[model samples]
Target: HTGNEWGTENRAELCFPQLFNTSCKKPTTPLSQVLLFHILMPSMSLLTVTLNLLVIIAVSHFRQLHTPTNILLLSLAAADFLIGLLFMPGEILRNTVCWFLGQLTCSLYNYISFVVTSASVGDMVLISVDRYVAICDPLHYPTRITERRVKVCVCLCWLCSVFYCYMIVRDDLSQPGKHNSCFGECIIFVEFIAGFVDLVLSFIIPVTVIVFLYMRVFVVAVSQARAMRSQVTAVTLQLSVTLTAKKSELKAARTLGVLVLVFLICFCPYYIVSLFGDEFLNSASASIVFYFFLLNSCLNPLIYAMFYPWFRKAVKLIMTLQILNASTYK
Candidate 1:
């Protein structure tokens, strides 16, 4: 909301200086910060797109990798891929400079961002439930979480994401850029009540499900470890087994530590700020926070795909061109 008077004749400083009081003044973002973002964000986006692409390819191309869990990962990786491919570059432009793209683009941007983010969240909940069932109810896991069921659930997740985000951004779509206080700035303001409901339904409820399921999975895993420990016969053998088991438990604890830390670090601030109002969403600092939240999408492949040995093998095959050669020979 800074004045064009301070901006002088600098069209660079004000998005549209000729409009005077109505023009959106660019935030006093430092050159170094903007330059750094210009360099880093695209690189992050490229890496995210590449890694997630590999995950998608690996899952799709290999028969051995076509499991229920991999299907969910593939769905999540696609969501991440879209974020990297579409949203990150757009955010770099929209946040780092004046948005010259106009209101229609802005509306579409917000809508797609919401849909992708919602799908990503839904995929996370699915992954958690998958793990919970696999670990806590191993016998039923095969029957309960078949590939057909996972595919159907994935399709439903995307469909629901599209429908739900439409509900959130419908008003803005009906009247393009209604929330923008000044020309050239892009902002989407959900009604406070609508935003609150979105917070509850899209974020809070799903995150609670993920956390609870993971906690339950953790408990089941621990109980299984104890059961294994109890099965050891000799005292010395039990001592050795106990030490190895303790090490494994410690490793699992560290992984869970990373999971909780990443979840809280990536998600909490964005939603916490959202809960207050879109006023914060309009601020420059909050744009940075929004970018930080988007960062979780980039990290997701690492968290979900990198842990699996099959993924590693798949990557190796793809990278070495073995898969291509195999296809050619076939």
Candidate 2:
């Protein structure tokens, strides 16, 4: 019934992979590529979905966890949630060589993917900027980047994201053969520009700013730690007791340093691949690089677990409660 409907056919084909019996024709894909594209993709899709959802629940259930930093985390979790729930599943289904969800759903799917993913990346950049301000400009940080500024930044991020998504959706469905399967095809100019912009604004610019700000913070903090150690020695000599002076400051500095390092590890791969693909790689290579972006969602929760004690505690508690509840019901 939907031979010309790319969206519907694509979703149906992917959702029920066994049902789609059409095998490859030209230049058969290698077994390794098949495994990577079909099996690994679906597994990672489900894993990413579950992890991101957990992040959302972990943050949401803990009322004490509603600081500005976590608010940004929550926003990121939301973005990842949409990508997992709506985009990955839908796109995976589409990849299997059919579209079964009809034209309207196809358009909506594309829109949600762009908007949610873009918003998530934007949130990360904003968070880095927030940390930079907090660390490098401590005395005036509160005044410079207030609660109101955060709210405005978040609001504007979503607004711009929605606008970008709208453009994509419009471009998808507004073509000459609106009902044809090809309408679901990506817009190259839009995607290329978007990728370039995201690579710069989302990762490069933010990281540069973060590095510069943290360098200043590092120097100041090191000096302060030395001064604190001297003061502690004077007091300890006077009273003949030990003090853990500057311990928390040193810890905080180390934590921030580690955080920047992890952020670099998680983001740099995707952007590096992105820049390389845009400049020289073919479509297939670029597509693989694009999938690497999903790895960030997987790594993000891990980062939070490593760095945030509250997040780790909440995850453990929630898992325990679920286990007990399941046994009780059993």
Rate residue 58 of model 1 by lDDT: 82
What overall lDDT, based on C-alpha atoms, would model 1 receive against the true structure?
0.79
Residues 1-330, candidate 1: write the lDDT tens digits: 467544675665687878877888875566656754677788889999998998888888887778787798789889989999998888787767788899989999989999998998888788777777777777687799999999999999999999999998899989998888888888768987789889999888998887788788778778877776675564687677655655554444445335445766898889988866887776666766777787887887686554556777778889998986553211
The C-alpha lDDT values of all candidates are: 0.79, 0.62
lDDT of 2 at 134: 58
Displacement of residue 138 (Cα, Å) in model 1 is: 1.0
- Clashes (backbone N, CA, C under 3 Å), per candidate, total 0, 11
**For residues 149-263, could you state the per-residue lDDT of candidate 2 as single tens digits?**
7778888999998986676456555642253424333222235666676666666776787677677767867776676667764744633332342454355456646655665
User: What would the TM-score be for candidate 2 when compared with the true structure?
Assistant: 0.69
Candidate 1, poorest ten consecutive residues by summed lDDT: 248-257
